[model samples]
Target chain A: MKKQWYDYLWILSLTYLILGFFNIMFAWLGLICFFVPLLISLIKGTKGYCNRYCGRGQLFGLLGGTFGLSRKKDIPKWMKSKWFRYGFLIFFFAMFFLMLWNTYLVFAGARDLKEVVTLLWTFKVPWHWAYHGTLIHPGAAQFAFGFYSVMLTSTVLGLITMVLFKPRSWCVYCPMGTMTQIICKIKDKK
Target chain B: MSSIRKKRKAFVEQADCVACGCCVKVCPLGAIRIISGIMAQVDMEKCVGCGKCAKECPASVIAVKEVTA
Candidate 1:
C-alpha cells in the first residue's frame, strides 16, 4: 500500500476550497477540475481521471478511510442503478446552467452582483468578505461565487455519503464520473 | 506465440480490501462488485484484466493475475 504522487492529491481539494474562501477569484481554477476529467476520459477512453486523479474523491477516501470517519455501510442498490445516476447527472447540469444564467444576469447588468455564495442552491451565505471589490466585471466575480458554491456543495455531499456509507460512495453517482463513463463507453465503441 | 495464451483477471485480496468501490466504478465491463460492503468480488467472466481497478485501488489489494482457461 505504498502511496503514489496522486495519493496526496486530496490536499489540492482542501487547498482549493480554502483559497476560494479567501479570494473568490481562485474559483476559476475549478475549471481545470471541471474539464480535465472529460478531456482525460475522451482522449484516454478510460475513467482514469475519476479513478486516479480526482482530488475530491481522494479527499473523501482520506476522510472516510484513513481517518475512519465512515460507518462503512454499503450504498443502497438504487444509488448505483442507471436510472438514478442518469437522473442525477441531468439535475446537476440543470443546476450548473442555472448558475451560469445567474452570472449572465449580472453580466448583462440586469441583476445586482450577489455578494454571497449559495450552498446547495438554497442557503445563501454572505461572502462579501471574500470580495474586496475587484476592478474586473462583477460577472466574473459572480461566476466565481456560483462555481465555488457548486464545488463546495458537491464536496459536502461526498463527505456526507462517505460518513453514511462507503468512503468513495459518492463516486457511484458523481455527475463528472457519469459523464466521463459515458465518454469512455462511447470512445471504446469506436 | 503459444497456442494457449495466458489471460489476466482481477483478484481481490479480500482480507485486505477496504471495499471502497473504486474498482467497481472504473471497471468498463462492470465486472467488479462489493459483496455486502465487505470486499470486492471480481467476475472473471466479465473482467478483461485491463488492470484499471488494480491501478485505481487505493489500498492496492487488487492484483491482476494470469489465469489458465
Candidate 2:
C-alpha cells in the first residue's frame, strides 16, 4: 500500500473543511475539534497529523516540497538563533494570554458587539479586516479571537521562518509543536 | 515456498513512523502494539502478514519483507 503525497493532502483538506464548518457553527465544539488533532499530532509527530491531516500543513508541505523548499538541509546559525526561537515563543504565548483575557471578559457578561469590534480594530493590522463584518457575533469574538490569534501569530512566525531560515521553521518554535514535544519527552521518560 | 514466507515477518523500523496508531488499532492478528515510551513493535509469531497493519499505517513504515526462517 504505497501512499502518494496527495493522499495525505486529501485527508487533511477533508478534516479541515469538516472541522472548520463545525467550528464556525457551534463555537466550542469547533475549538475542541481544532485543538484535539493538534494535541494528538504533537504527542505523536507532525507527520501524524500535520503531514497526514492538516490542510494548512499539507498545503505548505506540498508547496515547499514541490519547490525543493520543504527540506531543511542547510539551516543557518542565525535562523537557529536562540533569541529568535525564544522571541517567537514569547510572542506566541503572549497571544495565548490575550486570548485568555478576552475569554475572561466574555465570561464576565460584557457582551457589547461594538466594544469587541473596536478592540479588534485597535490591533490596527490589515488581517483584522477579515473579521470586520462577518457573521461572527460580538459575544463570540473572544473565542474567535482565541483561534484567530494563534493562527495569526503562527502565520507571522511562519513568514519570518520562511524568510530567515528554512521554510518550515515555524515547526521549531510553534507552541503546538512545543506542547507536543513536551508530551513526547514525557512519554519517553515513562 | 510457504515456509519461506513465514520467516519474513519479524522486524520493524521506528524511524519512519508517523505514530498515527493505525497499525496498532488495525492489527487483526493482534501482533503489533505501540510500545510504551517507544514506537510500535511487532510480535513475529503472531503476525500473519495479512497486510492489514501495513495497509493502515499512514507513514508506510510497516513492510512484509522476507527474512531467515
Candidate 3:
C-alpha cells in the first residue's frame, strides 16, 4: 500500500519523546496522544484512531515492518485473549489512577514533587537532570513527570513486543486501544 | 469460455476476529470496516481481494477467497 500522510505520524511520537527528554514540560503534550484516541472513538464510533492515526503504532510499523526489527511472529494466543486484554486494561487504569493520586498529593502540598520517572511502576529512575525548576505549580510538573513515565513505559513495552512479534502487535493489548474499543462498542449501541 | 467468472473477495471470520483494526488500516480501497467495534466486515463490492487485509490481520481471521460470480 502506498504511504498515506498519517504513515509519517511516527515522527510525532519520536519527537514527543525527544522533547520530553530535553524538557520535562513537553511531557504534557502526551495528553494529545492520550485523549485524541478517545475523542475519535467517541465521536466516530470506530477504531479508526488506532488503525490509521496512532503514532505509536506507526512507529512500531516503521521499526518492525520497514526496518525489519521484528521477528514477525504471531503474538501468543493468551495475550490476545479477552481475559488478559481486559485485565491489562484494568491494570493500566490502576497505574493511571496512581499517577493521578501522586499528582493530587503534590497539588495538595502533602508531598514534594519527585524528580524521577518510575518505570513499570517499580523502578524510580532519577530524572533530576530533566528538571530545570519550572515556575509552574510543582503539581503540574509532577503530573508531567508521571504522565511521561506512563507514555515512555508503554512505548518501551510496545517496542519489546514489536521486536518479538508482529510490528503492530502492541495494538492488541494497548490500554488505549482497549478503552477505545469499549467506547466504540458503547457508541455503536447508542 | 466459461460463463462463470472467479472473483476474489476478502472474508472475515467473525468468530475469531479480535477487531484490532489492523486490516482496516491496510485496505487500500477502504473495503474493510470494523462492525460496531467488534469484527471486521469486508465490503465485497469494494474488496479487490488483494490480500492486504488478510496479511495485515493480527488475528489471522481475514481470508481472501475466490468466489464464482
Candidate 4:
C-alpha cells in the first residue's frame, strides 16, 4: 500500500527535542509515545507502527529521500551482520544502564541532578574540544538521557544511512527495530 | 507462443530463504519482511510487482512464473 501523509513519524521528534530542552518530565512523553506503538507492533506480528506510522522513520524519508536525494546504495556488509547489530544492542544497553545509574544517584541525594547537569568533561580533539551540553531540561535525568540518546543517534544514523544507502537503511540495523523483529517472531510459534 | 507472455510476480519458496535481510534493503517499496525472523515473506498488497527483492536475493529462492494466470 502507498504510504499516507500521517505515516511520517519523525516529524514528531521536533516536539520531543524542544520538550527535552525545556521541561524534562514532558520530554519523557516521547518515550511513552514510541514504546507504546512498538509494544503494539509486537502483538500484531507486523511492523505496522514502524513501516506505516513511525514519525522518525517518516522524517528520514521526508528530509532525506522525498525532498532530497539519497545515494540508494547498499550499506557496508559489516553493517548487516548480526555481530554489528548485536554489538550495537549491547552498547545501547550499557549506556541505558549508565543513564539509569546517573538518575539513581540524583534521586538518592548522593550527587543531585544539578551537579550532574553542571558536570563537564572535556576531550580535546585534534582541531578542538568537545563537551557534553551543560543545560538539560528540568526532569528526570534518565529521561533526558533517553531522549538525547535516541534523537542524536537517530539523527546520526539517518544522516549516514541516507548518504551511504537509502533513507530507510537505518531501519535494517536499528537496535529497537531489531528487538521488535525478534519479539514479533517469538510471539508467533508453530 | 504462450511463453511470450510476461512473467508473473515473484514468490518465495520459503525453504530457500536464509532471512539475511539483504533484499529488504534493496526493496524500494518495503514489500518484503522477515517473518518470525525465519522466513522473508512478501506482502502481496505492498508489492507493486517490482522484482528488486528477487534480483537482490542471494539464495535464488524468489522466482516469477514464466506463465501468467
Candidate 2 at B51: error in angstroms? 30
For candidate 3, give the DockQ: 0.47
Residue by residue across A1-190, what tens digits does model 4's lDDT show?
A: 4646765456676666555555444445766645865676566765555544566666666665666656666556677667777787777667667766767776566764432221111221121012233354323554454455555555666677776676656665666666665566676763
Query: In candidate 4, how many Å is residue A80 off?
Result: 1.5
In angstroms, the error of model 3 at B58 is 2.8
lDDT of 1 by residue, B1-69 (tens): 778888999999876554446887668898998653445799989998999888656555678999987
Model 4 — TM-score against the truth? 0.68
Docking class of 3: acceptable
Per residue, candidate 1 scores C-alpha lDDT tens digits across A70-157 of 8877667677677887899999999999999999999999999998888887999999889977788999999999999999989888
Point out where model 3 deviates above 4 Å.
Answer: B1-9, B15-18, B46-50, B64-69
lDDT measured at residue A120 in model 4 versus the true structure, 0 to 100: 14
Error of 3 at A78 (Å): 1.2
Among these predictions, the greatest DockQ belongs to 3
Order of models, best TM-score first: 3, 1, 4, 2
Q: Native-vs-model 2 lDDT?
A: 0.51
DockQ of each: 0.08, 0.05, 0.47, 0.22
Residue B23 displacement (Å), model 2: 21
**What's the best-to-worst order under DockQ?**
3, 4, 1, 2
- Each candidate's fnat, listed in order, reads 0.02, 0.02, 0.38, 0.10
lDDT of every predicted structure (CA atoms):
0.81, 0.51, 0.86, 0.59
What TM-score does candidate 3 reach?
Answer: 0.89
| Residue range B1-69, candidate 2, lDDT tens digits | 455533557355575433434465457777987553235689987887777666544334568887666
Docking class of 1: incorrect
Return the top candidate by lDDT: 3
| Candidate 4 local lDDT, residue A5 | 74
